[model samples]
Target: MSRIAELTSLLMPHLMLAPIGLPMLTAALLLTMKEEQQRLKLGLNILSTLLGLLVAVALLLWSHESGAPATMGVYLPGNWPAPFGIVLVLDRLSAMMLLLTGFVALCSIVFAGARWHRAGVHYHTLFQLQLMGLGGAFLTGDLFNLFVFFEILLAASYGLLLHGAGRTRVQAGLHYIAINLAASSLFLIGASMLYGITGTLNMADLAQAIPQVSAADRGLLHSAAAILATAFLIKAAVWPLNFWLVPAYSAATAPVGALFALMTKVGIYTLLRLWTLMFSSEAGPSSLFGSLWLIGGGMVTMAFGAIGMMASQRLTHLAGHAAVLSSGTLLAAAGFGQNALTAGLLYYLPSSTLAVSALFLLADLIDRWRNDGASLAPYELDDVAPFLTPELMPTTGLNLDEDEEVLVGRVIPAAAAFLGLAYMACTLVIAGLPPLSGFIGKFAMLTALVNPLGLGSSAGTQPGLPGWTLIALMIATGLLALLALTRSGIRHFWAAHDRPTPQLRVMEGLPIAILLGACVALTLQANGVMRFTEATANGLHAPGTYVRAVMTAAPIPGPTTTPTPERAESSATTKAAP
Candidate 1:
């Protein structure tokens, strides 16, 4: 019974979802407010984000202090239990992912504050709902519950994708919605199959019960696993299944696009969690299902995404394609199935989320910057002048060299030039070229794949190494992304998109400085960061700590009946798990 209390405490952090959730709901409702009162929605939107940040921080503290896995409310509408009810589990990884989601969501909310409400119906509201779904996916332990969370996020995403209601965005969103809904249905079918075979909906219960499944059911189990994996792969943007991701991501807004950074990672998280846990057992000598397929497919997926990035043109489209590459990298790491790669994934997840979010937002600013300038490229630039007032082009312009003034449209400020440099620095780190978190993530992947003597060697014929090579070929793909970015950089400092550019403003430096600071800090703290990631990865693999926390207490004594007299034991045949 004490376990119940512990579970509730773990869920305390999830309450952070409410702050974002409520205002978003309010935004949807506030469409009734007179246009003159629209500021009310705006104020509430800002407040909701601030509230979410505080709650997320508080939850992080609670999780830290608890320092153990916990489960919360089996709470049901009619007090149902077991297969009839839903359950939420907060393990170490789940808690960490939730915290990261909250942090990134908070930042995106701040970015959208002034920009979103005017764009479409209940824009901020949908963003909040999306967060709710993301948080739920990380927190829920039940298969059906995860599906519900996945759908919730998709539901919100549909509106956000079409937020501006632009003809192109709306059409793209239709394809996105239709495709994802099919995936969701597949997820549900897979969940039903697992439940039918295992006779339990709880993940922990399934883990213990699946071991006892009959040989007759192995096909069912394997098929279910495959179907479930397909659903997540579709979500993860894996291989040929990922064709839809680029178009949808390209069509979305900067902040909306940034929000997607967490979406696919959530899918990858599900794959890693489900395969490494519940399904694969380290103690057993037998091979686990989908081990080779997942690893090999991951390699192909990485290559596909890299090719997409190389081929894409629009800056937004390029960033979207890069996400595909990142997805493949994540899959490759997970497929390697080594502790180091798993740990690297944990480390990579948050850093990449932040970097991607920052880049997407900056892409917007760059888009506007391009429109203003004219000359060399066919792309739009918001300005053409070499110098402008600080208000318009803060921390922007060409020729970031020390002596030359920073210019955007025409505004010049020393601080602004520093900001442009800062952005350049951040972009470099994200490309995995330097001492930043991305570099560390890549180093871990390389070690896991190529190390002849380490974890890779111990796992005979490991598929993860080949998978890593898939992304390695795309290492130059970052440069492809960098190529488009270089044009803007050159325009700001060396030349305008066409004519000489204008001075930049210090105000615009804010995001550039912040993103660069993250990269620099990540680079400096690589050691400590990698260590924690290792810890996270270890926890994910065995999840012994979590199992113990949930199932640890002495099992409740069941029956008072005496044991039956010993009978001849039958040699019951054992069946292989699917």
Candidate 2:
């Protein structure tokens, strides 16, 4: 009976994730029912999202109550032990990610209904499936399972992207398809390489096993890591590979664009999850891989995104560049791979996603603009109506140009304001500005990076701060990006003279509020959030926690299905605490 209870407790978290999967499955079933089942689909969408959110909340509560990571299980095709079969694990990270996925989906769905027509086939169904994929990716502890989720999402996104009939959309979707398919292929190849090397697919098991592998084989593992990173980087839109972003992001409808924000973050999340555990190289009494490759690469990616953003002319393209900017900034921070890097990454997940997502809705208004600014000149509201109205403007009006007619009908201008705020928030946070979380993360990473740790740790006058040239350049690049973004922000807001504008809707404004609110929340709770992120980063740096969690019931011969451990001691000397 006690065993049964333990098993039940273990299974509960997986049970929580089931709602996400069931909805997707049901969506597939509903597809064959009829074209008139839109209502059913709608109800399912709402029901599934609500249920998922509820489960996420439960898992979070349960995790807190138990004072440990949640565990769950569901055997496939006759009960079989994990190594030969598959299982899911729901750690704190998984639970947090699930909640975020549900939240974003719910908001996007609500906004979608208000705007887009129900003319399409099973629009809600595809959405549910997309949620299913996202939730699956977060919940699954198994690498193969992660791949399954990836395919699920990639397929769903392809369908969603191609929905409706526009020649440009079709063209864009095809391009999106081609690029993503290539990424998927590389992802598959990398997974295959990893499996061949390690012989197991469980992330936890692999984490334990990787550090044990011989140094000679490190080459293969690094190669695999590089390939995997490449796939995700493309998805994340790292420069030199981001040509598809401007066109794809610009072509999508507002709702589509909003949903797309979470898409690339998936890659960033994966990088943090997998690479940190499996590939880091540290030295000395506490060797860990805070990741030194960051300095040059990150700076370059940041510069590229900044250039793209500043150069963009149209609203759509500008939004696209903003997305690019997001990847570059976050990826650069992530590459630093320290306590601060984790903080920035945590802050980034919501900040940039919110900014870019809302910016799209704002841009949509501007894209269709044709109102003569001469019309609404008399009213202080009219000049700012396009952005201030219920549709485009968010609840926060603390930063608008009052009395001046400059903000009228131009969706781009309003979007520009939102972008500016979002950028300033992100830049401040990322560039490590004082009184902001970004500054804290940057400072921490610089501590780790230049040390004989080589990136941040320097001799004399600093225990944490390193005097590496790369670190200096990163600081410099961040300052430069900050200046450029802020200057552009001033132009977008202050440069505008009064002009006539149109009204906005409640639906449109919600995204902006949600996004900006996220920024505010991150700022307000930086200390607490950083504490949690410290916990997360500790788990990331110390593979044992991850390994132990995944390998809980492994056999004596040890993790029969896990990939062989590689570079085991490289991270052994590192000190990590959440």
Candidate 3:
């Protein structure tokens, strides 16, 4: 082979590992660095993120070109068979998630470089570890490994959430940690139950074994699945189970909050992956299991989110609830089980995630400006409204050399105008207003809900009351969001007392622009994106492809069975099956 061709061939098999491995290695190196080496840390962080983004993009493109779910890369570490060893599978869904994670992390890290990273020790290390955990979770091919990755990311997140120690953040972090620990325990119990029942921790093996589960044990399996789903739902910020999300997210510093926009989606992503693969139409009695629960829980979550959004006065709280809204919407759509609805949801997911992240960062900047002007003097009982003033400026200790610049005559208006316009763009995207990718996503969902068949096909059956309810909820949620954001925008930008325009650096502002720019690109390429998602949805409906790919690609011991001779023979036959 030619040298270039040989080199490509040599490295091609390991491409799937690059995204997960690079961040982990970077994080380990970062842990050894002194906190004072800001420049070195920042440079390494950016370089690592840039490389990860490139790898994720390459994986996405490769998966798109692969043309079949079975062809998507499945990397088994140590060259062991899939069910017997850890595997990293990269289908369109995983690849897309990887890309989104990389893109969002890149933007958040870059934005943080302007200030947030310096807020605490080992921020960059924790950030990279977070990426590693997310990537691993997305790519893993088994439930046991999923739990492992979840713990890794949650540990990193606990640190990141408390990065800048303060009363609010510390308190919120404690609650967040406590809740997730409980969830983790539930996760362990559920995984153990599943292993006890099916004798497999590999997701693909579980899919194969679940169908064969006896009627007598199906209820137990269902209970185990419920336990697992509950854990995921809590992480997804579903109603009642998600009380910790808003306070924790709102208390987090801006960049961490922005990166966290993807965390809830990770829960949604796991639900979609496991449910479709193991409990879809082909899973016999377990087919479409718990779907009603998904739909009902999702609707209630949306209702809660809408009410919260309307009531929220703070921007961070609004962003947190908006994320909840997105999660609820996706879960409901996933419950519908129609490929068309899922396709629309696939398009909607990334668009909404990007918008929420942008909103988090933007809200922080605006809040800084608004709160900076508050009175800093100690309260006196004799003074009226003694509790309403800020005891200290929001930027009390931060270096503000950039903000200290005095803009001459016309420059102030121009700067203010830029920030206002950016804020408006984010508002439009979040509220699903005209002409942006968010609108396209919601419009697609609505169209899919009305016509569970592909758009423009009259033969498609009309949806029932549930669909209509979802449609109404979607519309009402958007209206509520628009009103809430519009009111907040007016008060902050127009009615509030004029303060120094938030000092935004190029580094800080560029990340927002890039994210918004991605949204615009999604709008421009809506047709192509939708087409890809349609294919993805179809792949999701066909669980056999995923299972067969994992099982047949490498020989592994068959799922555990009874120790009787007949059962042993049966297991051998299954393991020997082509």
Candidate 4:
């Protein structure tokens, strides 16, 4: 046992880098193989993704077990000191994100193996590269490398978006590429400006420098931060800057869409990390910089997303809008800067992401099922049944048993039942209804917003106007989403009489089930998950701890030897003679 413990400790640092390196190496190896060997490639891709998931789980457990001020594992790739070397900081936040990325990637790759992998030339390679980029982005401790990983992921996403190569995909892919290219340029400019102002790109170093920045350059610093935030906001699909998200995400393949769900959260994660670190109460004049902008913009984004959802007719478009809604909620919660609210948002993030991804996958199956039958013509509002009157109802046939006794209920096909249940779960979760993880998360956030302090505290005060406004918006959006999803569900499952049951492959169905099953697990373990998120939030709010951990981390010592006695004596004698 002692030997195993020693071995594990020695190898843990290297394991910190495996999430990024393993996928990259796998992608490179995949390039050498022919496309004809797809089964081999598929197996390799799944194995790599599973390994990444395991590594992520291990890291999460390590971070959790290490306890607070939150143990941050800092790995210097070049064996150089902080602010000078490539550093990867694994904290609770980064570990959680890494785990989410691995799980989503694994599910997506498995789903793609059903057919989408064969849709393009280097699908598996690009998918692996996408995972590599996401892992790097989460683990990197510097702004420049964040940009590098951003480009890496976006470049890979360009190909994944156009996997099927249809006209719609080509159009959406072109727009996605153009917008991201522009955002990348902005990222570079903002990073360069910050580097010039602070003389360092490491996040910890930046945190240490933000408070000491000269008054003269403070405005420039704020400007640089805003410019950088604009880039992330665009990626996060926060309204106005998010015109392209619906079309782009709606057009991508199902598996690609599921993975793309995490891409938006990357931007959210960056904002959360930077805001809590650089603009905390300790940052003098820059304390909570841009809080109003985040709150106000997030509210507007939520409104836009709600309206978009209510108006959307296609399942894919509805799912895209739902993603936007989820992003908006997170952004607003982040703006509040309350520890409890932050914890709630952390819990909400994964629940909403999983629900949205499941919806995306389910949308493809439902659409295919619809396509398998006769197409229905569009109907006007008046044409939709205002209410099902007895006179208007059809009395065509009754489902009866062989004995002519009336059956209590109709027997639904297994595939159709699965689709309906999955869709229902997605709807309930996204709508933040009761008895699911989503409701628990939203309830926590609402409680925090209303109290802004712990319950039963004597000094508790009412939520201010902004808080009330956010609360109102959240409720309204939930109602709107419920209506929208219910309508879509009826059309897809209940109203359509001619559509055939979808032939769902195990590869396809299993991923959706796994994702939904995760939501169920979260619901069952809500208390434990909330505890973890609260600890993560507490660590994030205390920026000084993070700064100390990163800046004080020592590099691995290079090989060295003790001087021999004879050699030391001869050197001493020579020095004395001189």
Candidate 5:
């Protein structure tokens, strides 16, 4: 075991590249295969996705190891020093996100294999490309690479959204493509402005430079940050900029929608990472920049999502709005900038994502059950009966012989039972009910808010009006979600009596089970998870650690060379003559 550990440590630097490299290689290999070779493609996709998940788990464990001198691992693809070559940093946050991406991708691909993968050409290839892009986005340590990966993912999503193309999907895909293109432009402009101001696009270098930037450039710097934030916020589905999210997400197929649950988090993750690194207390006169805006924007977004959830009639649309609500909560908590609150938000992130993803999958199954064989036959207008006619009046009671006994209850089918239980679990987590991870997470954040001083510290100042407002909003939104989901549940499960039972495949059902099971495990292990999150949050607030790790990471040394005797003699003669 010790020998294996030593070998792993030796290979750790190279292994950091696997998350991105493995998917790229797999996609390229998949592309070479013929369209009829779906079985092989499916097997390959599953194998690659599973391997990626294992790698992510290993990295996550490595990052969390207490004995390590530094938790962040820096890999230079080109063997050049920081700010000169491409770099990938594996830290707690990135590791967690990588694990999450892998888990969701595995589930999505498995679900897709049941049917959705065959919906169009290159589905597996596009899926792998999307994974590669997401992995790259999380691991990259610079702005240019971030933009590159963003485009990669966005391009892949365009094809995925339009897969099994229909009028609705085509329309939604066009809008999705157009909005993201604008966001990309904004992203490029913001990155360029920052590069012009700081003279480097490396995140750590930017952090170091921000403190020393000239006063004259400060305005420009903030403006660039704002523009960059606008792009991220749109991706995060913040209010007023989130008009594209529901239509796009709801229009997607089940597996794709489940995978897309992580898309918005990318935006939130970037905001959390950059805000702390570049605008923390160390940045004089720029400490906590845009904090108020985040708070205000987040509150408004929560309200909007709540209202949307209540208004939406479709289950898919309801899930989309729920995602928006989760984003709002995360954004607002980030704005608080408290270590405890940040820890709680980190804990909440995965819980909410898993629940929302499960809801998306579940929505599809429920819709099929409700609509299958339940469509009414069309009739001519002349055949319609008059409502006022007594003979055609609706009857309230069943007609039966007086001696017949009514059956008390009928046994529910296995499929219906599974759907009901899964739906109930999703509802509990999404609505932040007690005895689940979501509730625990919200409770932790609420505790942090009421205390206002650091967790376990002596009492100090209380949270301000913004904090109070966020608290109220959280409670209110959770209630609204509960109401909306309950209404949806009744309409789908109880209101209709003649709907046929859905015949669910193992691939379709197992993923939802696994996701909800994870939420259960999270609840059971909340203490350990919260501790990890607190450590991660602490590391995030300390910018110096990240900067030092990145800036001091040395490139791999070149091959050693031995000087020839002739060269040595020539050098000696030249030295003597001089």
Candidate 6:
């Protein structure tokens, strides 16, 4: 074999480490650079993000081609055994999330490059650190490590949230920071309690041990799980706990707001991961413990979010509420615990996230134009000359003040046209209207819920109330979003009085175009994307394949048999007491 081929083969096994490690290195490099080194900062940020995206895409394709979750990549750092040393599992779900994170981070970074990055110190450093945390969380197979990454990302987010110093930004950042600190405390307490009971922090190991939990300890275990679920639910922004989401996200600078979109989904991802792995049917009596609560809470969240969307007068707040609605829909589907529903969720997840992020960026641009003082004011009826079509007026008579009159009959500004079209695109996608990826994803979900059996199944099995309820709420929420977005659009686009056309730079506009273009591409390749999500859902429903894949990744150095219930109980007691 050629030298290059040999080197590639040698490094292939370690490729899984690149996503997390590369960003850490880049963040350190960025931290040491001087603040005024904008050129170096921009180049390094783009290079690191591009490399991360490439690696993420490679991992995604590798997982897809492998065709089975069990065959998905599993790398045991330091060649350590399962459930002992750190393990990184690259299954379909994680790979997909990694890809999404990389793509979103890339876009946000590029958009920030347009100017947001310079608003504060260490912007690039914090950005890279944020990616490091996000990447580590998605890749880590250990719960404790998940918490570590959670804090890492949260810390980075604190700095990024206040990146551009302003009164509104500082207040929002404080609220965000305080709420997350409490959540972190809950995370630690819950994780410690679980560790005491199960004597394991590795997710695969916990999955194996959950079914063997003694009845005497079930109450304590349930309490720990509840506490942990509460923390996750708060982050996921389920109704009552979602008060902080809008203010923080809406107040953030445009690029940072785009990054915050993924932060919300991280909570959803954690809930799905731990709940399915630890509380599935394989875990015996603990199976589907909070399913009903999840469904009901999710429904209520959707209702509340819909109300918020309707009440919102600003585009940013409207987008924020849309995120809350998206989380509710996904959480409810997850609560249903059906492979078909999950498949639809996987499809919808990316489509909704990307659409909402683009909306945040678009909102910033439109706001700039509406508030800019230098641009020409909107055309007024009083500023126009009443025309009788005599067509013989002197050219000098037509000459008027540039700012006060429209010499060339009403002309639509290019920036305004761009914003208008982008707004329409965002509305269609966020509202799940037809001919976009959003509609297809929701349609897939509706069809799956309505007909659990394949399309050719025999008659007599109708969808339950839960399924129909979900459908109704989804439609209602979409309509609410439509109404809210329409009002905001009209206020900004048509009914405007003295608003100026915002000057949009190519750099800023390009990122928005790329994100929307991606949505279009996802719609064009909907079939393939659906197939992949279907496979992902199937793998999630049957998690044994995942557990086995991780467990068998390396030698355990002992007997492979699971411990007996009595022995496991004795071990649990001994560990809990210690």
| Ten-residue stretch with the least lDDT total in model 1 | 374-383
Q: Which has the higher TM-score value, candidate number 2 or candidate number 5?
A: 5
Q: TM-scores across all candidates?
A: 0.78, 0.74, 0.89, 0.90, 0.91, 0.87
Number of the top TM-score candidate: 5
Candidate 3 residues 1-578, lDDT tens each?
Answer: 59976786557658888877999999999999897787699889999999999999888877787565335677777568868888888888998999999999999998887666766778999999999999999999998889989999999999999876766777889999999999999999999999999999999899999999999999999999999988999999999998999999998878999999999999999999999988888888898898878888998898888888889988889999999999999998888777788888999999999999998888777776676522111112233122212211234423434432331011233555666887888888878888999999999889988766545322212358888998999999889888888888898899977577665666667788889899999999999999888878877878788887787666335587459998888889999999
- lDDT of each residue in 351-377, candidate 6, tens digit only: 889988998888777765775621112
Judged by TM-score relative to the true structure, which candidate is superior, 2 or 3?
A: 3
* Candidate lDDT (C-alpha), each: 0.63, 0.60, 0.83, 0.85, 0.85, 0.82
Candidate 5 residue spans exceeding 4 A from truth: 67-70, 373-413, 454-462, 565-578
Q: In candidate 2, what are the lDDT values of residues 1-578, reduced to their tens digit?
A: 99987996766744754745666776777677665554456556667777777878777555445444223333232134455656565555666677677666766775565434242456777887888888778766677778888888889888777554355666888998899889888888888887888888777666666777667776787677678777888877876778887787776666777788788788777877776666544212112332444434555666676676567655556667666666766676666555545544665566557656666665554333323322111123333343222232324321223431232222333543453465455446434476554455556555555443443221212223322544665576556556655665455445655634434444445555676576567678877666565555555555565555555644224344433344344344343423
TM-score of 5: 0.91
lDDT of 5 by residue, 1-578 (tens): 99998998889879999999999999999999998787699999999999999999999998988734338989999999999999899889999999989998898888777556765789999999999999999999999999999999999999998876666777888999999999999999999999999999999998999989899999999999999999999999999999999999988888999999999999999999899888887888777899888988989999999999999999889999999999999999898788888889999999999999999888877875675621111112122222112221223211122231221122235988899999999999988998889999999988899886748421212359988998999999999999999999998888988666675767778899999999999999998899888888887887788899899999879897786999899888999994
Model 3 stretches with alpha carbons more than 4 Å out: 1-10, 373-397, 400-413, 454-463, 555-578
**In angstroms, how far off is 532's CA in candidate 1?**
2.3
Per-residue lDDT for 1-578 in model 1, tens only? 78977896656644644533554565466555654444566566557666765765565455445333232222222234444455455555676677677666665665554234445556666776787788778766678778777887898898888765555666778899988988988888888898898887666566666667787887788898789889999998888888888788877776788788788888888998887666655423323567677667766776676566556656676667668777877876676666766776677777776777776766665555555431112222232122222222333322232432332123544633553665566456556666677777776666665663575222433544465464565476556556655654565446643633322333233543555566567678878667556655666666455544444323325567543443212212222323
Write the residue-wise lDDT of candidate 4 on 38-137 in tens digits: 7689999999999999999999998887566577788889888889999999899999999999998899888777556665678889999999999999
For model 4, the superposed segments whose C-alpha errors exceed 4 Å read 373-413, 455-463, 562-578
Q: After superposition, how far is residue 361 of candidate 3 from its true place, in Å?
A: 0.4
Candidate 2 overall lDDT versus native? 0.60
